[model samples]
Target: MADSPLPDKLDNARVLIYSHDTFGLGHLRRCRTLAHALVEQYKGLSVLILTGSPIIGRFDFKARVDFVRIPGVIKLHNGEYTSLGLHIDLQHTLKLRESIILHTAEAFEPDLFLVDKEPLGLKGEVESTLKLLKQKGVATVLGIRDVLDAPHLLRPEWESKGAGAALQEYYNEVWVYGDRSMGNPLEGLGLPAQIEQMTHYTGYLQREVPESVPSKHLLGVPQNYLLITPGGGGDGVEMVDWALRAYELDSSSLPHGLFVLGPFMALAEQQAFRERISRIENASLVTFDNRMESLIDNAAAVVAMGGYNTFCEILSFNKPALLIPRTRPREEQLIRAEKASDLGLVSLLDPRKGIDATEMHRALQALLKQSPPRELVADCFLNGLDKVCQRALALMPRS
Candidate 1:
């Protein structure tokens, strides 16, 4: 491992990150975090992130890190997707994306290529790029979260999609941002033993919050305010509506509720929710904030949809969380929330089971009254970027 050809100098080192942020902010955020860490740790490292998020420009990024935004697409209830007027079809979008990625690779001539979440990219968009990088002798890696899904669910899906084969042949390393004792993401991928040596459990990546910020919205809220969040707000409307209704029906249980309706939530849905919750004196609604870490840090408890990023934030702040995960499309959130609940890290409520005023009230009461288990808070801070940076550095071409 020590003999690996990582670059020693930070200057002139180029790193490319590929993040397929189709739906929510998790993948993009993770990539951004990794980019920031690399640039900060290595003074002259330049990082370029290629992402498909519609709201890429909304957030601020570090100095050495920049992103190229691909055409956006949204998933509909019928399981079909439509583009944001930028492309005629998903195929066109993929072609454009491929061109942009390849062009970026050619221009940047990256020393390392770190792909977030998607192993083979958006339906194998990165296959050609991976081949190009291999030919060019660029180090390639895959960054994955702790728990992708149940083994049974993931096995057939990956097999059918040829993701397993891609993993076996393409990526040089598989970095899991979680502990394997908790769960192993590659267990069912059925790769050869040589592939296992390329895997690393890099713990969880965490966002560090400053001691104070000048933002008045999160400044010293009243003692007992419950914080409600839905990550990117694309799929959070249902959870937000349920929480508002729960508060409306049982205002006595929840004295105050602060709803951070994510920026991406539909305008009509946001308006209706705001109007409905306005009548409830205990509830106050606001739009998204990049400084959500501060808000979560000061909250009494959290009621949210179980996105991996949000779950990590809640755990980092040691806030008691009530997770209402989405089912049907992807069971990632459901699997995580259930496992966390089993470990007593949080209270998982099934959206299918129906969240009534009674259940909400009971759960909130218990969380606020009881102390969250200490083990739930054990070593949850995973500063994985440093390790990843070191690994990438090790893989870089030595002078």
Candidate 2:
């Protein structure tokens, strides 16, 4: 392999991160953490993130890190998508996204391109942009979470779409943001052993919460309140609804429940939920919160859908949690929840099998009354941002 042409001077290095946060917050949030870590570790290095999150401005970012927001699009159940607004069509949105990506790369001329999760880039939108970057002799990498999905489900999809081939040809390195001992995301991709050599496990990257930050919700609520969250609220309506129903049917004196309907939750759905749950004295609904770690840390227990970022937050906070993962499209959450449960870190419930009010109440009771198993608190937890930043910096071009 040839060495990269990027300048050796750290002050001249520019890094660009691409995160397609089309439907959820996990991808974007992960990229932000990485960008911050990279900038902090490599002095004088500047970072830019290209994201499709409509609410990108809502979050706080460290200095020298910035983002360019792409037009929003939402995927429907039938595998089709539409622009998020009345003015933009799907084609226009794609074009706009492509233009912004290309323009950013051209202007910034980043020495490294770290792409999050999406290999083909936003339904294949970034292919041309990547080609352009490669032509400019820029180094590119793909950063994936521990589990994209079950191997069986992910294999055929990648094979049919030539995703594996794209990664092999375009990406200089593939960083799995998880330990392989937990699970190998690339096991069934049919790639050769040489491809495995290009892979590096960076362990899990978690946001560090300051110990002194106090939680507002923890102020008056008794020690029994359980925090319920659906990440981004795009596909989390069912889980939130189930939890609310459980609170309504409580025969025992129920703990106060705080539900955070993420920012992306539909207006109609939010209004409906508010109407239904407003009458319940124990339930409080709020929009998406950036300071979720504080809330999670102070909570007595947690009920959530099993997204990777949310799962990590639950683990880091060391709170007893009940995970109700989604079943269809992909079983990423289900796989993570089951593994964590096997490790005795948390409880898992299947919504399809009928998780009613009684079950929710019982699960909450058990979790609050008992501590998470000892095995759950083992060395599986990682704080790996520094190590990942080191590796990324090493991969940058030397003068």
Candidate 3:
């Protein structure tokens, strides 16, 4: 790829983001956050995100920040890919996604093309789009979260996917959305120096309190309650179960628990969770909330599985949190939880060891005693959004 010269001036630049939202809400949420931040920073800039999230319509979007919903696909628990709500083969669904992605790129003609998580998209679905954009000299960036997974797991996964070669061949820049002090997503990948030179650590994206909030009636709970969220709740059943067990074990004078079980949780699991929580007087369950930042901000404290988005919110809102990270499928959350615990940002509770009601009860009590994240970290730790805007400007055509 040839170096694209920096332009002389800025104008109504356009940006396109691709989010291969196969499993959880993380990819789509991250892309949406960036899209909102970018358009807010640049007056005339518009960001159009291409996502495969079935619930994309559920989330609210600001003006000049919109999404194009491609054919939705989902990842099954057994690590198989299948179309979401469509009775078709996975290959056909992938082909449809790829065509829509390329078509959107051609029509949008964005000045900057940003991709979230998957370097080459799900099964290299975005490979052709990236190549076409590179040929057109559209600046391409790969945005990744703080921790992908354990090195052992990530290495084989990337090797099989040819992520390193794609990074070197297609991307103009790689943005790690995390502080290097916390963790590096690309730590042991052993990519070439060219990829390293083009990479930037943009820190974690900061979340803000939403302008609109759900009323107490809508939330089915009052303020100043303890928030328990298993982000996206697909793999969060354990966390939720543990929390409920804790409450059941000791219905002491602890804070009221409000659980946001996430949207992707299985129907049977959700029903079971509801039944369990119904018996617990101090706990209330909400299956999902699109505007979760509000709940996080308003909480007295938080108990959650340490997903990337939740980590950002915990810091952004400076809440005292206890993270019970999952260790299977991927150790990304576990790695992040360990790092945050080391940094004194949050407390860690590994479910691998044991999540008995007694242990969970102790953790809940400990959460309130822990200091808020901002008190421990520097004030500038939440400057990821500002830095990302600056980096976007540098990569974008100013003319």
Candidate 4:
């Protein structure tokens, strides 16, 4: 048997990313984007992601990067969790996930460790690994989205989950993937001074336009179309339905509409959407698009749920967008959308405020017909990956 390469013998910088993605594609996608950006900026870097997203394998990874899929845990809409497609008990599944995470960190011995979103991870699953990393003197950073939630909810949740303590004791830094002038992800909860000082606003991770994408003509779409995307589509039925309803009123509101119904949308709901899509002469629907950035680049405008990743894309492309943000479970999206609107970056349509097809159509018409004054948001933050790569390089040991 061959001996494993010793730590000093390894020539590449290793970064281990933990994305406890209980649901949706947001966290995994962000981590993967950061990973790719890091590899690009810092040559001879190897990346490994520990992810629990069920669809982790569906997306392709770049060279010198891969993932170990942790046992899946599903978080229901009502804030409950269960083993995703696993016959084992939830506790066992979590234990198995924890074991794999800790084992991977130990074996990988990465130069830096990045934890996405949750500070202690889902139900504190990554606590042991965090502790071990701390003892090993591994540089640790917790990467948080632009919006966490309403401060009241975040305070209680962090307190009960010991997230604040974990942040202070284990991690060396916390990077918010947003600009501070936009909104603080930690605004509501009064974090201790030390921990607060540790947080750095890295700005938004701007997605790069793909080198090549199918042309609008080749994709069988008109020259101009409003791109309607509900992100992962798990909680996107309302947005998709509303867009279709808007089209029913006036197809001219948007000359053409291309809807990317995420794969997580329920089959029955998608079928219902397909029925509606059939009725709208100028609207198109695709169940999924692995490279959504390409579609974003080609689209004339955007209408979306205003998730963090989607907002980043809209900012990157400077797309005139109508954001219909959900205000349930967490008000992160709602708050972000409102803030972005105030900054003249995007417009918002709060779904809960008695909005209907007419309202959606009005928003759509405004977005598609009128290009937003891009100059207002000309200074918006979009170079997060660059800043993050710099910080990581500074923090990395002399490997």
Candidate 5:
């Protein structure tokens, strides 16, 4: 990475990231990735991530990157959110979150405020914080993923949350972490001309193999395996079931499979997978691993839900991948999978068409021998981190 131009002033610059983190590990993980990258690029830059993920403590942070844990909220299957642990009602919980966020911004006094995905934040919890930060002259940015839900679903949802108004009033810029070749995530949102002008496409964020690698003995990593992950595994039961069934149906044709069931996956689901994996000679299960990049780096191929972070890693590592994107709650993954598949970056097996075990088996086998992504796309696709750093430098005020 290029060195920051204003290193002397960078020591005093700080970036605060807000990750709503209501459902899966996606928000927290993406924030962590950006935090790490920013600190690495700018030598004394401090990145503080404010998150509501219950398992935020599980992952490691770099020297200049840290996190402040707010009260947790969990999104239900029915699209409602409830406090993850507190017995307080949703209203009380949201108030508590709002207060915490506002106080953190006041205390931290960040040079830049980056909000992940949610424009107004979870139930508008970050609205007060955004307003306060704006008055304090903090450069506010909205970092959205490559694809949000379908336009129809996202438009109504954003309208209900007053996202458009929030963007127009508070945020200084909107950063789309994707390439235009893939698709425009905000295609039909109908933002005003000014907001559209503020938008910048930073391509896809690229991941690297971590500097430190844990011993295989410590992680119990199997040899020459295929990595099958469903992101946080909150809604991954069906994907796991299909993969296991594929193995049970025919294991002789496939390589050893390492399943990383995420921490948020239910206890019952983990136990069931454990029992099933024990019976299958070619399959093994791990509940969760913070060092996921290392595992993906060593894997022969990958099968995953095609979430943003995982997709970046697959492209970064140049692994042949088979994506089975979920269509419920949001079509983000499905949209991503379709676009990447069309570009020949990854193969897609749409669940909307019904995922048959036989088809899954065939896909996995094909994936193991398929060409890696690097052969197809230019190197510019993974240049998101560098572009983001450039934007950050431009946004920060010089001393």
Candidate 6:
């Protein structure tokens, strides 16, 4: 792009990221991390994120990175989606979202396009945009998390949406932010050999928390206390509540439990959690923190619901984490937790089988006594940001 006589700086090369955020903050977080990483790597590089995440404004952004907030949609428990606040029909809302996305890409004229997860996006909202970008010779990338839904669920879901076809035609490269020994996000989809060859395992994304940021003391959490979280907290009520329940059972054993309830959790449930916190002596609560990387950094050990970004943070920080993975909604988290536990990267509690308060306490105690688990640290790669930046720059010439 810099070679096109546009601007002198190599930062003239830009990247456009799309996140079809149906539910949680995972998609948005991953995109923002990548945007920040790329911007930091190049002097004049600029990154624009097109996202439907409701809480996108809550986080601070880097100088060369910003976001365009697309109209949001919420996924219902019944698997149907509704406009976040608009009275318009879901179809009409999607049309509006599509227009904003396509128009932004056209105006931004990025040298590279990174589409998160869903190849075609929600109901194929990003399809036209993908087509137009490719026609303009944009290097389109599909940046998927380590594990998508289990193969059985993912295959049919992709087939129904015709995502396989888009992957074959629109995208130039498929980057899986995980190690292959973990699991392929596209396994069992029966992708053609060419599509498979286009895929690259970029390893787990590495996250860092700046040391100068406000400390855990701000949350009333003492040093050496357990840090517990459910990233974005909408679907994490079960796990978050379980931590509170465990604390209630024995505050002495698990003193000073710090719970960062994500903003997406239902108000009533958050209020319920607050009521429990008021009754408990040692535990404190904060609704949300944009810089959760800092919280994870200072953690004695982490108890997290296994989301991709959370897992990445745990891996990068080398925090001893206990995962309580949700079985329903998609088996991706469950599968990831199981494998990570097998590798001794972290431990897990299967929500389906439902370990009780005593078992939860035992896990917490074990974590305090033990060095944070890291049997496979050398085996897995967490330097994905560097690789992504390299691949992205190579797509566009510097000179």
Q: Write the per-residue lDDT of candidate 1 for residues 184-289, one digit (tens) a residue.
A: 7777767678768988887666666644663467554566689899988888877887777777777876658889998888899989988988798777888878
Shift in Å, residue 395, candidate 2: 0.5
* Alpha carbon deviation, residue 269, candidate 2 (Å): 2.3
**Cα lDDT of model 4 by residue, 11-105, tens digit:** 57899999988777898899999998877666688999999898988887888889999989889978989999889999999999999999999
TM-score winner, 3 or 4: 3
List lDDT for all candidates, in order.
0.78, 0.79, 0.87, 0.84, 0.88, 0.85
Query: What lDDT is reached at residue 18 by model 3?
Result: 93
Candidate 5: where is the Cα deviation over 4 Å?
Answer: 1-9, 215-222
The local distance difference test score of model 5 is: 0.88
**Candidate 3 Cα outliers beyond 4 Å, as residue runs:** 1-10, 212-220
**Model 6, 113-221: lDDT tens per residue?**
9999989989999999998988888899999988998888888888899888899989999999998878788889988888889998888888888458675445556
Off by over 4 Å in 2: 1-9, 215-220, 373-380
lDDT of 3 by residue, 1-399 (tens): 111242323467999999989888899888989988877777788899999988999999998888899988888878888899779999998999999999999999999999998899999999999999999999999999889998998999999999999998899899988888886688898778888788788777899866765534235576678999998988988888898888999866568899889998999999998998889887888888888888888898999899999999999888999999989989999999999999988898888888788888888898878889888776556677777788889888766
Cα displacement (Å) at residue 152, model 3: 0.8
| Model 1: pairs clashing at backbone N, Cα or C within 3 Å | 6-394
Per-candidate TM vs. native?
0.92, 0.91, 0.95, 0.95, 0.96, 0.95
lDDT tens string, model 5, 256-368? 88989998899999999999999989788888888788888889999999999999999988899999989988899999999999999999898888988898888888988
- The TM-score leader among the candidates is 5
lDDT of 2 by residue, 41-146 (tens): 6668889999888788988888789998888877787768888764867888898888888888899999899998878787788888799988988889999988
| Model 6 misplaced regions, further than 4 Å | 1-9, 215-219
TM-score between candidate 3 and the true structure: 0.95
Error of 3 at 66 (Å): 1.2
Reference-based lDDT, residue 389, model 5: 89
| TM-score of candidate 2 to 2 decimals | 0.91
